[model samples]
Target: MAATALLLSLAGCQCSPSESDTASKGTNAFQRVTGDDVESDRSQWDQVYAQDAYVYGKEPAEVLVENIDILPVGRALDIAMGEGRNAVFLAKKGFVVDGVDLSEVAIRKAKRLAKEAKVEIATINADLNTYQIKPETYEVILNIQYLQRSLIPQIKRGLKRGGVVVFENQTVDQLKLPNSQGIRRDYLLNVGELKELFKDFKILHYSEKNDGKQAVARLVAMKP
Candidate 1:
């Protein structure tokens, strides 16, 4: 199989069936936005992360696990870092890590997990849609599962020269799966779209594949 067609298991794709139901029911509130419109999204995620168990499990994404050695260790940022599995992993590997998430509950859980692992990671609770990443700041950045096209420029600007970005998210083919309901098409990457997004960067790894459960796009690229 070609590199982009290889099937590989990745973590943090979605919550379990029970967990999904819980998030829809809105069982918890974390950061309360005063406006009725602003709080819905955050509240839903807060509910998901509020559970006793981690919604996406504690293991870091398989892509990060496989490609860590090639990435330069320095200031690392995890975007939309729900519960901080990746952040903690990078910290253990000796990176100064910062994790940002909209859910305060998730941030709290991430801190707790870091404490349990005897590592320290700075956690920021902010909406990625409005969050501003400092220009040319991070040596490594991880954008796993979460997709925000509007944030792409910020991601590019946030990296210093030669900085690498590791990203993985569901592809449009994911709708072919049996359990793909409620997953919005707008959120899915189109075929070859992932590569096209980082066309200017030097791509180290790129793949689009179906692994029985879901179809996903994975990419590792370095700034010029």
Candidate 2:
């Protein structure tokens, strides 16, 4: 009952059921927009890409770069892949990489990064809130710095048996700013939420800790 009420209150803002069910289909994902304006978020991110001169400055997240060797070889999916740093990194490591993001400019920049890095990557511009993950499609998945709470099931479902998912994101406590980037509290995880979501999978590692800038967690889980 509490969950239902919370979902209702957070509708159109968070990763609730409806968003999870239909995120991929929308050209204009108002629900996924950080705040009231999809055009604004799109323009804002486009400017960020432009300001950086069409290069997202592609470098893998520190955590992902450090643990690259641990990823099992196979098809991989990277969510909210800004600049395709993680995706290109995976490709360099010999994995077939597909990266998805919301910003077309980001996708283009990611492709440019991949080309510059001398690697191949597939980049998709889509709203993840409504994107559908094909069941049992990938062997390894990388989701870093992007949180789609309702994606827990899609991630699990999209992984082949023995598939691995390395997911890292901010926790509710990471909201140190006076106002968050419009990400709702209900959408952010509390400690232990990731572990609990993948409890059925084999957990290679799971940690919830602070890294000075944020309260965050990383989970490496394998589908049974």
Candidate 3:
């Protein structure tokens, strides 16, 4: 079932050129993708990758690093793990890792980075909404820079008992600040939304803030 979900998720990928347009005449390039049309096919990621290099530069996410001690030496999962940065990092730290995303191109790059990092990580190209996340399976799960509200419950269920989830992503308020045109409210999270959505679990940490153009909410929650 998970395999089927992975295959079907990439069936309609499309990346609109306008989706990559400039926010102003003389500003930095920002593609704040909006809309609930996450039904994108593989070609959409291909378009984005064609314009950039593999791995999108490899480095562990800081949030994951800071909370590394909480992660048991067991299987870990990475949701929307573009370029494999976090997965490879976990592998290096002695964890069996599985990375999932909707972008084949991104998965390829992630593989390349994993090889470059001399670490092994299983990469699954699948959309989160349809993917069958096995319950209580992983000791650590990472969700960064991606938002799909429906996946919250499954995420809690997918963790091993006492497992931890580190989530970091932009919020709706991010665009309210100055120079916020590169952000999309649809693609961003809302304040307290994370806590409310995953209220059944135990929240270890939570923060909502806008740092420059990045409006983000981060939480380290545990499944009882």
Cα deviation of 120 in candidate 3 (Å)? 0.5
Best by lDDT: 1
Please give each candidate's TM-score: 0.85, 0.77, 0.80
lDDT score, candidate 1: 0.78
Writing each residue's lDDT as its tens digit, candidate 1 over 135-191 gives: 999999999877778778899999999999999988888778764555567777899
Model 3, 1-224: lDDT tens digits are 12111111110112233323311223343443322444444555555554344323455666778888877778999998877878998999999999997778788888888888888999898766688789889988888877776678788888988898899876777656665554546566778887777687788888887656456688888888
Candidate 2 residues 144-171, lDDT tens each?
A: 7666667888999999998989987667
The TM-score, computed over Cα atoms with residue i paired to residue i, of candidate 1 is 0.85
Stronger candidate by lDDT (2 vs 3)? 3
Question: Which candidate has the top score in TM-score?
Answer: 1
Which structure is stronger by TM-score: 1 or 3? 1
- Residue 224 CA displacement from its true place in model 2, Å: 0.8
